[model samples]
Target chain A: MTTHPHMALVLSRICARFADEERHDLSVLRDVTFSVRTGSFVSIIGPSGAGKSTLMRVILGMMLPTSGEVVRNFSRPAMVFQNYALFPWLSALDNVAFGLRMSSVPKQERERVAREKLKEVGLLHLENHYPAQLSGGQRQRVGLARALAIQPDFLIMDEPFSNLDTITAEELKADLLKIWRAYGITILMVNHLIPDAIELSDQIILMGAHPGHVEKVVAIDLPRPRDTRGALFFQDVDALTEEIRKIS
Target chain B: MIRSVTHPQAGPWHRIHLMRHRRALILMTIVIGIAVLFGISGYFSGVAWPTLLEAVLRTTYRLALAYGIALVLGVTIALLVGWSPFIDFFFPFFDILQNIPSFALFPLFIYFFGFTDQMIILFATSSIVWPILFAVLTAIKGAHKDLNDAATIFGATGFRRVSFYLAPLALPAVLTGSIVGIAIGWEAIIGAEIIANIAGFGAFIKNVDISGIDASAVAGALAILVIVFVINRLVWAPLLLESSRRYAE
Candidate 1:
């Protein structure tokens, strides 16, 4: 029941459950409480079935929490889905412009802004390619561009890089960081990769499942442009990984 | 996996337009050419060309009317059946309804509508409606969950959701279903004409010299083939290709 002036989003004791097909009670999320700070990058990291995605759905208002409240002080929140979710029928440019169109932006302005966002995401040249024609990394870039084109107050990512290969994932992480820094937009992401959560986030909300709830909140106070190869960075990552493992 | 054959540097919209128009143009040309050939052969065949033409035209109009009714009603009914949980209980009834032979109802329909074009059109519609309805139902049932989520998240609701998301997603199924429906419609329309001894292609075929099947009857059959070819090319082929390019997985 507390609110901070600088808070972008606040989740107060949120709970979500759904009945199975056979009408069996199944609790997916329970008693989850957290706040995302303005312009901060936060990662919700946990093992699969830890309600990471369910928590996201609750925040996005895609699914109603069985109980509790989510308070948002921001406007125009957009999500980048795990599987890219780009319309297969639309080319990259049209896909990126989709949100703008939904918001009733004029066609000319929508395309211009979409192209600019595509450029920012390093996919301007591939804007004419359909999602089916793009590589995994390229498709994710389109997804990111689409989310950014809406000029959201905050961005939600559901395992944004989990679909890519190792090299592509790394490249995308750097690109995401660049975009986040440049835009200064608040980001709340769900990731199962412990190292990624440690590396990219300003704060990590570690979670545990079986009726999923928050386990611990760990702050990654590491300096920006973090050197992942450095021993201190590795030490921090290892510690965070161990903490997550112990909780899960 | 499903790249269009366009110039490497072509803009996406430009390519889309080009591909659409190009396929449409090709199909139109084929249809026109077939119609012209049929016209030339009919002129030389020395058959009662005027009566044959009248019957063909009559059958075309009737079939078109019946198909139109079926398309509108089929899509509407299919969407209604697929749309909500309340309607879901009626699906088992629909399952049984679709399996019932539409042709078997012709005699019963004659009793109701009494040997008129109304009966024939209704009979043809019965034959046409089921395939489209079933195809759309299957499409709705198998629609991608992610796409549904995306549409909901993007604020496509009510009519907007139906027009933009559900209709487009169900398009491939719609096209395939229409093809089947139209084919069945052609059969039903002709059979109705013959059985009812109505004024159409089936009547033309039935009344022809029965000694060994006259050249005029052969010409009539060829004309029907030409119509089918034209429809397949101009209507179904272009749609099928477009669906493969945009809608199909």
Candidate 2:
């Protein structure tokens, strides 16, 4: 019903339901409404059974909402998964070039572009390795590089750092911020990590379960390169933590 | 141009190539040496070397032709149905067809092609096609849903999906199915030849002198075994190794 300028995406009264055992309708998402501004970083954080992943699928157009409307002003969206979905049969370079290959780009051109992306991700040395041969951090980097190769207007991530070690996850988070700034791309991510959501997001959308719907949207007014150890950072984290606890 | 791929350090690719060539040469020498000994002895424990080799060549030709037909037919049918919406509906129908006795249908083949090589080859093809079809069909049906989603999201669609994603995904199954099909094909081809008295290794063995318990039959069996071993070593083993390494999830 309402609109905003430079809106990358606007979901209006979105609802999703699936058939459970006994063929009965089980609602997962209910009338979820939100708008993402272009080039802003947004995070959706919720507890278990809050339909976070289901909403992600709906947003990516991988699954249709049972009833609702999604208005998209941006095209060429890409997704990064928690499990890096690299093809086991392809080398890292080929994996990164997969989208270009599908677009019918010539082999030489795609490989050159893919190599540049790999170099950007600090993975030029491992371009010849298969996904199975790489460590988890390295594999996710390849996945990130693959998504980046398509020159997407928006990036969707579903718990991208949940599978890695603490150190690796932290490193990737900083790299992702740099990537986001450099590419000037919009990001929509879903996760249960409250502190992480506070640290990286321009806006954090909180959701409640039992037919998931938005609880609140909190805007981070802090300056760029937010200092997590500072007083204001922890205050925001504490307030968001309280909000999440109340809904969860 | 695409950059040439090479490991940072020196690899064993050259050494492995050299070893394979050496092994093949040694096996060839042994096979030829056996024929020479048979020729010089004027009559060895086996049949005359020339007749044995001739029969082998004939049978190999027939089997190769039959297998070629089976491969093309089986892969085509499986892929056509496997990726279709009607795959589940067609599966049971294919199952019933596969259960029919291949030998019982030989009279029908004989009627169509007479007692010629066509009849035997067709009969062999019938027996070989089942393993390949079922293997590929099951593989496509049982693949992880995520892989299909990934393929679609990355821009593989329509014919491109079939060619680039589905075909490569089903390759390991194809190799396994072909191996099984070849084994079945050999039995069908050899049996059909012996029964119909065709000009192949089977018939050659059937007509040889058996007063000394058939020297030529023993020789033909040994020769066939050697051929099967060499083919497996030179073709199937390497292919299998490569498939498992490259296609594994």
Record all residue pairs in model 2 with backbone atoms less than 3 Å apart, i.e. clashing. none
DockQ of each: 0.38, 0.50
**What interface Cα RMSD is found for model 1?**
2.1
lDDT of 2 by residue, B166-238 (tens): 7877788888998999998888888888888888887887777434446677678778978887788888878
Candidate 2 deviates by what RMSD?
Answer: 5.1
Question: Per-residue lDDT for A98 in model 1?
Answer: 81
Write the residue-wise lDDT of candidate 2 on A74-140 in tens digits.
7788888788878787899999999899999999999999999999888999999888678899989
- lDDT per residue for candidate 1 within B1-249, as digits (tens), equals 998897643556546766876786687678667757866876436678899999998999999999999999988887766676445677678889888888788889999999899889999999899899889888877766666666666656666666666676677888898999988998999889988899999888887755345777867877887788778777887777666666423
Error of 1 at B198 (Å): 1.7
Tens digit per residue, CA lDDT, model 1, A1-248: 56678999999898889998999999998899989999999999887778887787778778899999899878778888888877777889998888787777899999999999999989999888877668899989998898898888889998998899999999999999999998999999998787788789999998988888999898899887888888878998889888876986
Residue B38 lDDT (model 1) = 63
> Which parts of model 1 have CA positions greater than 4 angstroms off?
B1-50, B77-93, B207-221
In DockQ, how does model 2 score against the reference complex? 0.50
Tell me the deviation in Å of residue B228 in model 1.
2.2
Report the lDDT of model 1 for residue B227.
Answer: 85
Highest DockQ, which number? 2
